[model samples]
Target chain A: MEAFKETLLSSFIVFENQLNGQKKSELHKLRQKAFEAFEKYGFPTRKDEDWKYTNLKPIIKHDYKIFHPKEQKLQLDEARKYFLSETDTYRIVFVDGYYASWLSLTTHHQYDICTFSALINRYPEIADEYVGKLINHGDSFTALNTAFAREGAYIFVPDNKIVDKPIEILHFTTPHALPAFQQPRSLLVLGKNSRATVIERHISLSANPVFTNSATEVFLHTGAILDHYKIQTDHYEASLIDNTVYQLQGYSVLNLTTASLGGKFVRNNPIVKLIESMAEAHLWGLTKIDSSELADHHTSIEHIAPHCQSNELYKGIFGGRSTGIFNGKVYVAPHAQKTNAFQQNNNIVLSDKATVNTKPQLEIFANDVKCSHGCTVGQMDENAMFYLRQRGIAADKARALLLLAFAGEIVDKIQLPELRQYVKRIFNQKNHIDFDFDL
Target chain B: MLKIKNLHVSVDDTPILKGISLEIKKGEIHAIMGPNGSGKSTLSNVIAGKEDYQITQGTIEFEGKDLLELSAEERAHLGIFLSFQYPVEIPGVSVTNFIKTAINENRKAKGLEPMPAKELLKLIRERMELLNMDKSFLSRSLNEGFSGGEKKRNEIFQLSMLQPKLAILDETDSGLDIDALRIVAKGVNTLRTPENAFLIITHYQRLLEYIVPDFVHVLYNGKIVKTGSKDLALALEEKGYDWIKEEVAI
Candidate 1:
């Protein structure tokens, strides 16, 4: 076994022994089962079909300190860079795997908005009923997170409640000396006919090597609506593996958008299951990376019940020897007679050395379902570039305008105006173009 | 203000414009009329600094500077504009936004601050009224899903907005209804000034009836075979280009 894997196993044993009388708890039992699974599978290699294009050798080679992270504090002005400060939101913040109460604005009235550790202590049965119920046992990264990660954001909206304010889950890593490995586990459960919007992000303040293995599970009861956004634009020295799972009941609607400017090595796995009739899932993603950075997104949407619909669109812009990978799958079960699933992946490779690998997979077992998938990998439209340049815009500025226009389609779908502006500001800062569109 | 001497242009080594020369002075409008594949558009594209066409042999001097040595955007900054024959669609950029960017880029090239928001908006609204464009049209994507007439009118709208010193209208009247043509022609006429010139490239003489030109040049087989006054446009419209072809053959 790899030295890092062995260290993780021995550390898990020590951490479990430190639980004291809590070892007999159901959450601890679940953690024990997850540990056994991780022991059997260890970390995934490039040989795994899901990880064929991403190699983890360089990421796991470092001796990361995973068990204990030193306490770190951040001032409001220093940490305000990651928050949507212009808009009012309920915030749950964590620094190096420990909850930061001073920087958070959680609520417990009418609905539950607090940390997982607090929820686990106050409502253990509620935690046991939903904590690891939606994760795939085969995903070893998720199992590793389930075994050790203890603190993250948790929100529960009861039936018929509408949370007008958005909720933000922010995780920042302030590594001390040695390389740090942090895992965060978050969950959101929406009761019947409830509605909410959530924004999640991972940021590192320092230029230290940090590896984050994060997982989030969302359960939408009947008629629940959710608009979720995940922004991943961390430090250049960081590496992140994020796994997100969503299970929708009857008549539930899920709109999730992910914007990744990216880090050294990043991989995103989002699995969505439409388990009941008339559920809808709209998944959109935009990734722009340059200079040897890598961003790989593997998404799956399974239609299990009749009359469910899923629409997926993911766009990528890769430049300066960067590599991007997208593998999206849409599956329709035998009973999903009236299912409608459509997926499209488009990419623009700016440099000759930049590479993009895109694949759209569709497996439909029902004859009456409508399923279509399309993928394209090409460069910037030359005609469009010339069109903009002929209007007194320089070549580089014209290219930036067209690239932003290409990305604007996805950014426009953000329901929140402040959030949309935030994403646009990030796009400008990373690409070095000020595309002011007053209209 | 513009002079071209012994201009020869080729695309992939296939000669498109062969030994063509023309001159245009300020306060004058020159119309280039020809049948399909006569390299009328090629001349305009080369002048606009499109990279696809190679100027095998040519010397184009615009206001005493070597035009061929500059990029397309630099040519634009030097007060040269080409109203594209087919405007490309930019889906997410609105008409107002694109024109604002273009006007500001032109100003930036001249080291001037961007036009203030109120002044720009006033100028844009005035130009839109001249082109008969509704206010809602300014908010839509640049030429995306616009009708043929709307697209032509939009070209004129941009032409009026930029107000270039030398504007080349390449087949601007090809895809337009009679009303749209009249609106576009009126817009052009209103924007005309004694300090700028217009190079109108078209196949028919219908548009010339509205915006009368000072001279008409018949381009045949990549060369200007005939040059006459506005009466020449009427004669060509009446007799068709076969007369010019026979004249060139002789």
Candidate 2:
């Protein structure tokens, strides 16, 4: 315990040295509050109810070097290699947790666009207001990220402003010599009657083991609409811990879709807080696991106000000895009447040794609310397999075809033409499935 | 040619085919008629190399090759086909893909190249016409949500595609309607050749009127007690299975 304290204190000192004057001052104040809360509540262990399936000891034990803001040139051709669609959307690139202005497109006239580092330097007051407001500082990982939050992206859509093209922000991590840790944070504020779509991609160029602890806070005001997509396809040696909080106000709509394809260990926590009347949210997620990689998704949808609606569906496909964990909870607070919440988690294990642990829970304090949760875990149907094989398809090819059909349910729901095709391509390449879907 | 000599088989240690023997030469269509629980279906399953039955003492030769020593898939590759009584349903697998796979596997086993997609499609369409099946059946999942008649038609469609040497029909007429029975029998008759044979197992003489057989054998209590020409099936229809049972007892 003493050694852990020393490690935390030293990491904070290193974080302070990497920031400028105004950013350092803001972090100093937030650090003081976060430290107090951290002292009150230490790191969450397996004993904690929410952290039962995922243990963070492996993350804390390693001494991760803080990634400082440095000027580094990125290969533009390589950066644009994976974009599936050709559009006039603005592209922003960040390297090693710091925003790279040279690689980012100019948004001079676009009032809805701003970088996190530029906003922190220009309007410190706006950054100070909503930076750490949505996230719980007592959470050790969140606090650790707050202490070292160097650079990310910030987008604000004013009232009645609709952004036609998706804003793509690419967060790339490059480990030069030693193992590095980067925490890229983003704060999206969608004003009333405004609509926009943001796609956040995390990529790694280095094959060495690295850690990325990312936190994104989305604030949807009354009558606002936001569509968020997170694509995490890092190298197999990389680890990712991402936490996203959606705080919805009255009559706002927020839709979040996440795809986790490549990672050594990935833990995604998506929290939706319906704070006002008639606020709605939808969360859809798909993850494909192979080899010994592990992916865990923990989501919480809280209906704090009356007449709110939320739906969540998460599907996973596990092969080899890989393991997947999904825990979804819907909490309907008191006085939040007429809250309709539905949650479902389904997983298919291809190999005999693969395992999946899914738990869906519903807690309703309001009497008039309709809330339900369900989970299913099973292998492929044998009768179906025999039927296919008798028709003359080899066993292996038949299994692959069924797996693709299983994944089609979620892949078909993606509305973005470019991203949908990109997802299908990635799924096909990774699973070796011969899919002919033209999407 | 197919030959079976004194086949004694048991399922779960219970005797099912007790010293049953039969022979079928090329260009012959033989029907084995029997009542319920008379080991008619067991003979078909055993000939197809199903694992559950134990051939205590039997010798089955197909084209001068030992049949009992081959695996189910191997038997299929060696021109043995069994049209199941109850067809299994597989979702998300199209019928075109299933038939293509089956055809290619058998072709490879016979040291032949895979059929091209264009030619395969042409063959499938021709067979569909022969069986009077719907063209949409080729695109839908294999047997999923298919009606009884449609399932039987699909079985015959597969038979037409495979073109096996010895085809075994195990109660294919059980759930089919009269029209479906006529279409299926027509498909079977069209596929018959001088080098191909068939062993039809049924409980009734209704199907024999469509696809007339050369010989009909009466199976009683796990053994064939009488053998005669096609007229025997007609005589049995007039006189029920009890006549044969009493004659065997005497």
Q: Pick the candidate with the highest DockQ.
A: 1
- Model 1 C-alpha lDDT per residue in residues B62-162, reported as the tens digit of each score: 99999999999999999998998999999988998899999999999999999999999999989988888899998899999998888888888888889
lDDT of 1 at A183: 92
Chain B TM-score for all candidates, comma-separated: 0.99, 0.98
Candidate 1: deviation at residue B102, Å?
1.2
Best by lDDT: 1
TM-score for each predicted model, relative to the true structure: 0.97, 0.84
Interface RMSD of each: 1.2, 3.8
TM-score of chain B of 2: 0.98
lDDT of 1 at A173: 83
How accurate locally, in lDDT, is each candidate?
A: 0.90, 0.81
lDDT of 2 by residue, A1-439 (tens): 4455566677776666656575446645886677667666767889988788776666556665664447585666777775533356767778887777666763736454768777677767878888888888857777766665657888877777787778888888775566567788788888888898888888877766677888888899999998888887777878889888899999999888888887888999898999999899989889898988888899989999999999898889998888798999889898999999988888998889888989987788999988878888889876455444444445665576667666766776677887888887788777675544241
Q: Is the docking of candidate 1 incorrect, acceptable, medium or high quality?
A: medium
Chain A TM-score per candidate? 0.98, 0.93
How well does model 1 score by local distance difference test?
0.90
